[model samples]
Target: MLPVKPFRQRTGYCGPASLKMVLDYFGIRKTEKELAVLSGATKKQGVQDGEGLVKAARSLGLKAALKDKATLADIRKYIKQEIPVIVNWFSVNEGHYSVVVDIDKENLYIKDPEWGYTRAMRLDTFMEVWFSIRGNVPSSKEDFNIRRLIAVEPHKPRRGRAKKK
Candidate 1:
């Protein structure tokens, strides 16, 4: 595991979907409880960067640097930043881009640009079965957000069972 060093450290929140801003944060993916579970650190890494895909891509990297300006922008364009597991572009079609991000039992901060707001996805419900577990995205690209795309999946019932119709 890459030593628990944050990719960047900024002064405050940057607002909206900007990778550069997100990277400056420390705890973007793991919530306090989750961090306690994962790193056993007294402090947590929750609510760091852009969440989901960004976090996953970052952690999986052999080097694990916060997505740089170009990289972040590139990713925002193609991959859904909701789950860190979405390490790259091709996985966009697998419908398996699920990963925990800024989770807090009731809230799950995602980063798909389209997935405006949703929370607590019950990650245990879908662990490593995600799409980009192997982590295979080349370093980000220029004019990344220019493409404007979306990642879709069969909606899993938010509460428990989909109400039996």
Candidate 2:
């Protein structure tokens, strides 16, 4: 499992905060504010999609892809590769982004920015929350599937200080 630090989201900055945690795991250092600007996150709308996150990751020299219609198997696959994924879920009648850090046969470990901590969520809960954004899409183009995620390719650590465990 990655030692990804959680950031308490400032207002509607969950998207940027989640991205920051994933980037941190990949050895990419970026502030949440910077990520917010790069991801076009605003208090009014937050992050509408993962495209901006992909762009931000690419601009920071990491490969990132926005994927839809993802499943629990996909999340497990990425975790096995030691790459944290940024996933969108429905909570409190709105969409939010959280980082998937690890997984097991029955539980998925997630670092929730809003909660400011990492916790284990049951696979059943994962299925429900991960695929719960059916009719609450912000746009037609984003309506392909509510199971959206940002897959970022992990790279070697920078030749500086190693991340503390």
Candidate 3:
């Protein structure tokens, strides 16, 4: 299993919370409040787009890549490398963000911030929800057409930080 820290978002802070989970896995401790400010998220209006999430991750010195029209293979590749991915998909007729931690032959393990737990779903089911968007507009049933994917890669830590006295 990937070393992902599960976090439940506060109000409309799902973006920040998801990013927080990724940051935590890299040994970077940052509060959701700080991430909200970095991502230009407000109490009333949370992160507006994937760009906000990219900007927030970049601010912390992590490499954040936003992929458009990402495929299931892309997600599986990242999971194989032990990198959790933040995916924007619709769940329960609502637009949401969650972390994809593991993928087996038949199922995908998702760490949903809103639900505060890891849920498993078949690959076909995940794809249906992930790509079910209407035109370019985002609604309850179909949220956004682009199907954006965010992958946060951590930089290798320097090895000379501690010296023997």
Candidate 4:
């Protein structure tokens, strides 16, 4: 008999799984000393971008779910082996980092409202972004973190510099 689990039908998102482990895994307010330990070697390096953890996870095998259409079982199984997460450091107005969460109806749930990239998204629209990021889904690097619709005001810069500077 197959094992029955809660949230069995929903396609659990891998984004949060890996991210949760990444940020929350280590000690809070990590000192430069502590951060150095994570980076390896014994050198006091200034805040390196948070890309390292996400990069390492991909090497281990974590992928994104397309169209917000992934199975909770599949995600759970994946997480059991290794957590999947996304690393986003794009924030001009808000925090650069955010963890992707679940999807319901058509909106992609996310942690940290500051990013303001994906206030909300349609399932179909998000899928396209997801697929676009990785080219294809369910890959050997099956787990992936996606950066989608990050609102960068390309026009705003020009707005302030009007009338010929």
CA shift of 132, model 1, Å: 1.8
Q: Report the number of the highest-TM-score candidate.
A: 2
The model with the greater TM-score, 1 or 4, is 4
Better candidate number, 2 or 4, judged by TM-score: 2
Q: Model 1, which residues run further than 4 Å from truth? A: 1-92, 95-101, 105-108, 133-165
Off by over 4 Å in 3: 131-143, 157-165
Q: Please, what are the lDDT tens digits per residue for candidate 3 over residues 62-109?
A: 889998789889998888777889987876654567899888889988
Question: Which portions of model 2 miss their true places by more than 4 Å?
Answer: 132-144, 154-165
When 2 and 3 are scored with lDDT, the better candidate is 2
Q: Rank order by lDDT, top first?
A: 2, 3, 4, 1
Which clashing pairs does model 3 show? none
Q: In angstroms, how far off is 137's CA in candidate 2?
A: 7.4
| Model 4 per-residue lDDT tens digits across residues 9-45 | 0011222222333333221122323323332312222
Judged by whole-model lDDT over C-alpha atoms, candidate 4 comes out at: 0.31
Let me know the TM-score candidate 2 reaches against the reference structure: 0.85
Give the clash count for each candidate: 17, 0, 0, 12
Candidate order by TM-score, highest to lowest? 2, 3, 4, 1
Which has the better lDDT: candidate 1, or candidate 3? 3
71-117, model 1: which lDDT tens digit per residue?
A: 33333332233323122211233222222234443333343322323
